[model samples]
Target chain A: MDIKPIFKTLIRNPVGLVLIATQVALTLAIIVNSLFIINQRLDNISVKSGIDEDNTLMISFSSLSDSYNMENAIANDLAFLKSLPGVNSAMATNSLPLSNSGWSSGVSSQSDYKGVEIGSAFYFADETLVDTLGVDLIAGRSFRSEEISYYYLSDELEPPVCIVSADLALTLFPDLNNPEEVVGKKIWYGGVENPKFAEVIGVINDIKAPWRGWSEPIFNRVIYVPHKPIFGKFSRYVVRAENGQLDNLVKNIQTELSNFDDQRVIRPPRPFSDIREVFVRNDKGMATTLTIVIVLLLLINALGIIGLVSFWVTQRTKQIGTRRALGATKFDILTYFLTENLIITCIGVIIGSILAMALNNWLVTAFSLSKLPMSYLLGSALLLILMGMIAVCAPAMRAMNVQPAVATRSV
Target chain B: MLKMNGLSKVYRTHLVETHALREFSITVDEGEFVAVTGPSGSGKTTFLNIAGLLEEHTEGSYQLDGIELTGLSDRKRSALRNEKLGFIFQGFNLIPDLNLFDNVDVPLRYRGFSAKERKQRIETSLEQVGLASRMKHFPSELSGGQQQRVAIARALAGEPKLLLADEPTGNLDSNMARGVMELLESINANGTTIIMVTHDPELAARTRRNVHVIDGQVTDLRTVFNNDNVERTAETA
Candidate 1:
């Protein structure tokens, strides 16, 4: 309760106070920011990709003869995949979700595709796209069998109709609150020289772009066009097996497909779980490394406090005895030391808030990071204060046990 | 008033037991100034520690201001020390980091006094000890005599019924020791009982009575002095 006097004495002899406080400040700054990044990676790793990841697998192959019919080959492959036992649906498409390969493009609501533009991942598939990828059609209707368009990448024609992801629907038509209202909005694409427009025939609930390790604003901004993209020398299909049958199908799909179409070289089939694993591998590693760093920093900070407070208790033994003899109870002595540390920790946290913000500002410039929230600072400050109290407990108890008779001795 | 009857203190270890006080008996009336004189390890400090509640005696009954302190908890003893007793030590024991005002405020803070009352008592006690002008000065900045005065102010600020001094002038020069003795006599004249332990016979002679101890037992030195009555001091020891 003698905070003013105790604080005055502490500030006059500030070496120990400054040392421990600097460690607290540094630890808080680093840990809070590191925790933010770790939470970010963790959040990304767990975000819903809006697909049935457990039941989907991808098979890709390259044909030996470039003179083959692309549509016939894709139709034949799809028929074989869907006829297999336990297979729910199948589609020959451009790329799979959460895979490293992607198709990104810019689209706009204005003619010539030049007004308030945003980038999006484009998926080219047939009428079975919804059934094959297992994405929910929250509003409007899927592509009809007669509306399906077959083309090669060499042709510069864009699909006239597409089903937009929920995020893309909201961005392209910001005024519309309901997804059903956005079902009829048209967006321009393909560039100013060859301006092409597509009507939004439907809206999927959600989906992520196949890319990772970049800014997050573009992940769910995607659109799936009803186009069966055909390349003469290359082909791929996404097949959905019934639950619990994906691993078995993945094991046998490549061999079966290669045997059925011997003119093409079939690559291995990968289940969606494997694609997701490869996507977040580096992010998980970064999160784990930062987590270890935060824990070690906290330990070092706690140890620094323990060492400093123990030394203070040792050096001030006679002072403690004097206070005890002056009618201070053991509990009073303990309170004195704890209150003193609380004051120092309070000062450190104040400085740490500023330091954490400063560190976050630098991170924003270097890595284009987001602003650090105030909750992180408050939470981390509470953590540091708790750790400080725990670290100083043993030394404070030692201080409390100093013999009152020490005052009568000739020190 | 203070009383101790058949008080005994034992220090025990795994190998040996040392009896610091053997059936010690002492009685001091209200407003009396008593001096306890003895050599080293002669139980002078053991008596002082027991009287101040700094250490507990193994066996005995101790009463201060008519309250029995035997078998009390540490919290109650601390409360009694803060409420009914004051102490001034040989080394002054002034916390060197604190200024004169804060040093004097130590005991009052333990007594749970309000900030206004604590400050008032601190200033008044410093004025009584002739250090009112140096309230902001640290103990290190003051002379030995001034530091002892600050210690006296600290003890006086509590306004206790009994004051205990353990070699209050052992570390001071002759002139400072005489000045401190005058202050103690002045404080005693204000109707507070005092028991000071000292090695200097000259200082012991200045008190109204003396109780000498040797080897854990009371020894009547029977010093010739201008005592109005020797029989009363004799009966107390």
Candidate 2:
């Protein structure tokens, strides 16, 4: 078919064509940006926490009685949790991964704090912390049983040994090529005035901290110290259950702890997966909202095309009848309308691709997001074209069904 | 050549059934120019539509160039129409957005002619209508007569075997009507069959044969002049 005639027709109605094209372009820009943000959030949510998320459960409680000895209560709690049915291992720790709140301290290679200090989450647990959290040891060994010690409130006791994550170890000793070489190196944890040095006994593969946003680089920097009672008031136990035993353990663990001692207020036991869900709930909500907006945008864009095409069809009824009388078939009429819409959509898509990339660039500069890939742009262009075609189908069919006899009648 | 026997057309609704044509019949030889005259709403347009294969009849046996037309699929009928028929309307139905040349190319495009062939045919047809120099002018840019000529050029570009004109000169002044009539006569002189529906007796008298329709039926059939009689009359004049 000769598109020259169609082009001429469209040029005559420049305002209408431009409006449709602008609508398509804006729709493309909005949807592409929304998709990019949604994808980024999804990727952030899917990052590995380097913990046994499915099998681990955390129980947090505070000792309400002033006479409650934190050391004895935590020891009793750990023993009771470990003896429970289907419980693999248990340890009392200061904080749990994905808990959304934890303790953090700065670590430095020099005892005099002469250089920059790297911030890391302080994960103080007993000798069983490594096994209970399911963190893999890449080099050296975990703290020995004799190395475990109690930490009271405002106590100045320095731990004999500590374990660092692979990321933290690299940050602490950037000059060292091998991670194993930093295993025995001593690092300062507390203030410079009373510098508490603990030898790095082991290097864990990767463990995420709960102090900051997961998107930050400091998320995986963790330093584990051998402190049996992580705090004086609160006793938080990290318990690992056998396969398929999480839901049952979470349901009965509160009652079991209460039976052991009723003075402390035991919060409900929570699965690690639930805590992770709470940690990233805001991101999930943003992704869902963006997805909804994209769907609505596509629907509105499709409706715009349908409305414009239907109006054009109605306006050109006599012209369609004339073409029908001139030996143009139904398919010819349908193709003419579809091709006209395709031209408009193509123009819009071309403009929209540039607009989408520019918007993505702004997003990267403003929020530090990754650049939008070409695959998304091409995919969105194809999707918009398909949407335009679908939206034009009904109006094109209406044009196709115009009777040739209408040409004989006066308009 | 065209033939229709016992053709009937019924326009139906839930409350009424109106007969547009009943037992209508006509035939035109391959090289003959025939005019159909009727009062308003007397079914001349219905006959023209059926004869052009633009519509279906309620009851009929129609044949065009010896091929059965009734009960054919829409695709087959459209192919036949594209291959063998052309139409000119009283409204001078030139698509306003297209220029004269593009207007003439409509049927050729549907006929699947190559670009070069379509361009040649469009030029030739526009030249025949004396509008070749104004081929790039849009319909809105031309006068009424010029637009009609473009519509006629559109009809001629397909080189159809049968040309159907429904009051093709109805919208024109007398002078413009005569010019279009002369053009039709010249086209028919080249041996293309024509069936023209008109309300003017004078125009009908100029054709080789005249058929009068009334109340959805053919009421009269007469030959105004044979080819030999027309030639002799022309020579004597």
Candidate 3:
């Protein structure tokens, strides 16, 4: 059980020990970093978008003819969609959550204030927008039916009323304890010098906008203006279905839209969940690739330990026999080998902990990744130690089975 | 302290069964030094292996210090070996990586001796072999005689009731062989039973008793040599 002897033995075979230790260290570093990144990506993809992802479908279209009347076309499509049998609510908006594109603007508490502005994604929709998106209205009331207006791009007019997300409201009125207190507050949008102010009619629960990055702190900040029948060459429709009717709605949406305006080209209609999947597809791919790399790294490290231990067993056959003849039992021999490997693995783990932190620091600086937690480093060390033991088992058993009579044989 | 009755060892194969030892029997009293002499391939090593508890006999009733060895589990057997027996090999099988102190410490470690006790025993055993000052030196740093001494120290550190030596001086020069033999004599004088296998006639003659074996059977050297001398005297008359 004296590790001093084991250390001396390892010192004698520096090359093999160093090689195995280096392999273990590298494996720990790579696996820890990969797992951290994978965990981060998983967390990013799991962020709640505050939409009824399963029940809502987003359908987009662009006007193919220059003479297409955007306002009338959108109104007809909305009415037809609303009349569908399973459709619970339908509203046209500039963008859909998890569709990967939206509009952003800077907002301020005071129209004349010239300071850092809070940035938020913009959503322009009608009174039915809350119902279609399934967003919870935590305070105040949604826009009135009469407050909705069909605004054109050439009209050069902004909606007088807007709903702000709870997060955005908190940014505007940080000292306010209640969201109801933020209801009558006014926020100025556009540039401070030429600001346009709108009353905060309602405070909705958190919702993520499509264009925001998962790492951004303001991902949930959004403002909704009461604009109906969005006037543009392209328009997005958010349609909500009754329970269990999402698939049916997605299937029949293109036909429904085309029946309203045959001159327009309709893109495919997809469930919000599918759009979210497409949006974070790269993140999922990254997680999968990192998982594979971690698995391969562990396997290679195990093989390296096995190979080095096997070679040591072969090289020390006579020594093992001598120990056996000198009253060392099979278990003693086995423990000696296992303990030796543990020492080597411990060395690697120490070096690997440092390397893992360094790599995480680099990631944090280079890609804005969160710092690696100490718990993960400790977990990785324990894992590698276990791997070292498992990898050394066979070779140690071989050493144990060496006959004491082997010492009596010459050479 | 050691006894074997009707011991038989058979080496089996698909084509042939080699009888390494047939109906072999031997006994050594407590505190006695006995030497076993045999030619190459004469089953001496087989007997030594079985006697050391390193290999199982095909059929035998063997007892060491009044404990039945047959049919014992490997754990029991190993425990018994660690508690009661020690071994020295001709090749001076000292682990090259370990220093002389640790080489002596190996058997004591297996015997479950406390670290302090192990250190004391290792130091005393090395000192007995006149290598106490060289305890820090590795086996590779020592001469042939010194390495063999370290092996002897390793065997002695357990304070075993029985010490088995297999050609303990085979790989040494005559001077070194003599030195190892003197060390063995001193150890035997300390009342520990000793069984040595040797091909050297001089070494065999030095022991308290010598047993010669050939063709898997023990031969009575006294009867055979006396009979030959009588025949030569009659031919001369």
> Which has the greatest DockQ?
1
Residue A19 of model 2, lDDT score: 90
List model 3 lDDT by residue over B1-237, tens digit each: 988888889999999999998888877789988788889999988988888888888897999999989888777777777788888888888887778988788778778889899999999999999999999998889999999898888888888999999999988999999999999999999998999999998897777677787877765332123433521111100
Each prediction's RMSD to truth: 2.6, 3.6, 3.5
Per-model TM-score, in order, reads 0.93, 0.92, 0.94
Using lDDT as the yardstick, the better of models 2 and 3 is: 2
The list of candidate 2 runs beyond 4 A from truth reads A108-117, A153-160, A171-182, A186-197, A211-216, A229-232, B221-237
lDDT (C-alpha, whole model) for all candidates = 0.87, 0.86, 0.84
After superposition, which runs of candidate 1 have C-alpha atoms over 4 Å from their true positions?
Answer: A64-72, A149-153, A175-177, A212-216, A230-232, B222-224, B227-237
Residue A341 of model 1, lDDT score: 93
Per-residue lDDT for B1-237 in model 1, tens only?
Answer: 889999999999999999999989888789988899989999999999999999998898998899899999998888888898889999999988789998999889999999999999999999999999999999999989889999999999999899999999999999999999999999999998999999998999888788898888776554445556443334335
User: Which residue pairs of candidate 2 clash?
Assistant: none
Selected candidate, larger DockQ, 1 vs 3:
1
**Taking the tens digit of each residue's C-alpha lDDT, what string does model 1 give over A62-88?**
887767777787889889888888799
Question: Model 1 scores what on Cα lDDT?
Answer: 0.87
What is the C-alpha lDDT profile of model 2 across A1-411, one tens digit per residue? 667778888897687779988988988988888888898889768867788889998898898877788878888888888999989999877778768888787779988888768788888777886679888888889988789888775777588789989988988899988779998999897878878899999999868888454344678889888886546567788899998999999999999999888989899988988888998888899999999998898899899999989999998898888888777889999999999999899989999998999999999899887899988888888999999999999999999999877777777
